[model samples]
Target: MDKLHAQRAPGRPKQNEQNIPLQEIILRQAAFLFMENGYEPVTLQQIAKICKVTKASIYYYFENKAELFTASVVFMIQLAHQSTLRYLEEKDDLRTRLEQIAKAKMMHAHVDMETMLREANPHLSEEQFGRIRKAEIDIHISLAKHFQFAMDQGSLRSGDAMFLAHAFSALVMLGSRKHVIEHNTPQEDLPQTVVDLFWDGIATQPQHRK
Candidate 1:
């Protein structure tokens, strides 16, 4: 019995053909669960269950639920950054690209990021907090770069690219609010409406604006 236990560790992670690390698989599933439910409500056991791994197997990769939650949120943020880049790269027209990004973002019901982070706050360390913030900023910077390019080309009025990016993000976040969304406006039109509102304000003949 001792020899058998030594040969096969109890916490050995499951393997896959793609060679993706068990850590990544765990992070992916954990991110989904954390995003679906808040950090406080999700447990390492639940994450392990979702990933089809034993709780001890998760412990091999993460120290505790807090560490797992931090990693999961960072993973989710990086994935969002990648998805945003793909959408932005799909079109050249600023309005069209913005609309595409908005539509993709609004397609799902968002767990309010601010609220989620607030819930996770006590569990995260400063380094963990920094990681999440950097990942979130990566998406903003990508959008800002695109906005800067359009501004440089005289396609958009001269203004702060980063601010525009933030404004656009805020406008899209409104789509996630139930009361605002429930107000007569059709769900399908929300993305277009958001883009229109953002564009109309900035798309005025390329004049230098403070």
Candidate 2:
């Protein structure tokens, strides 16, 4: 982050120094701005103005708008990953853990996926884009192991648990992405629904025999 002193009149008080530095402050604010206005629409000048700093100061830290945008996006991605990891580590049972992982993925999907897709541009390095896909695959691998163990126990139907895991993942991605596209509902609602649907399957329980 480009460090800059408070531009406010000297009367503004030295106590302001206790807050995070201006460059870091701008990075935090930049993430929100990018999410709201998209990375392309938001200019460095605009970010500097919003953060109450000068353009030169922004340059000191980011060098250019693209670098700033990349850093902000990377920060957001890390936060999403940390949140998912935290939720996923909570459960001991394989099935239960898978459910938690699915739920966490859905909850942040709106903020993470939508923003990334909206801001994506051809000029941006695909190398950076590769990180997003790899992180997703890593998450899928972790959850797939649970399915494998469950299959070995015979608690779940036998077959290739790995295939079943992948199939379930595909189904969830479809539902989750569509839910984002169609309803635009909050992320929490649809992922939870998808998880429930997955564990139980969509078929309704048959009525009790007379």
Candidate 3:
């Protein structure tokens, strides 16, 4: 990664006073900037400035802008997957757990992942894209396992767990969208509203017979 191109400057120390690796700092900053602005508009210099490091520091870890972009995105996805697992495990009841997960997701403004990936597609190579896809699939599989467990406990209807997981995630994403909420809709109520809608669909119910 260090061999691609060296700009006209004396190299800076790759570690800060706190002993944090320059590569980790660069990835965190780059992830935020790329998610906020998309791949095309974000520049290595911009990330360097935000990270309080020289552009050469970033080049030390990443060969080029495309490589940096890919690494940062994958890092962000892995962090998100870790966070979702923590949230999922916080509550025992499925409804409460889903609400907690939704609220955690809604706590921040989010760029749509699909839209972001589409914007980044032209710059990323196949292997870089594959890494990101695998990270995304990991999160979905984690959620699907929880859904399958709820089904086994008879809390949810017997259906495709993976599909239910995807459906719940989609509903949360839709609820989290800025335009979906009205001025009067309290932010605190949104998670419950989303979970209620989802629960009303696949939750197990008493069978009715004439």
**Candidate 3 residue lDDT tens string, 17-41:** 8898878888888988887777889
lDDT of 1: 0.81
The clash tally of candidate 1 reads: 0
Candidate 2: where are CA atoms >4 Å away?
A: 1-23, 92-119, 131-189, 205-210
TM-score of candidate 3 versus the correct structure, residues matched by position: 0.84
lDDT at 173 for candidate 3? 80
Q: What TM-score number comes out for model 2? A: 0.61
Clashing pairs in 1: none
Q: How many residue pairs clash in each candidate?
A: 0, 0, 0
Error of 2 at 175 (Å): 7.0
Model 2 per-residue lDDT at 14:
19
Top of the candidates by TM-score: 3
Candidate 1, superposed: residue stretches over 4 Å from native: 1-12, 17-20, 179-186, 202-210
Candidate 2, 1-210: lDDT as tens digits: 113334322332211365776656777778778865665677888888887777876766665676677677667656655765675567566556656666665544443354555566554667656665566566556556667667778877777666766676766666656655675555555665666777777669836568
Error of 1 at 20 (Å): 4.4
TM-score of each: 0.83, 0.61, 0.84
Error of 2 at 164 (Å): 7.5
Question: What's the best-to-worst order under lDDT?
Answer: 3, 1, 2
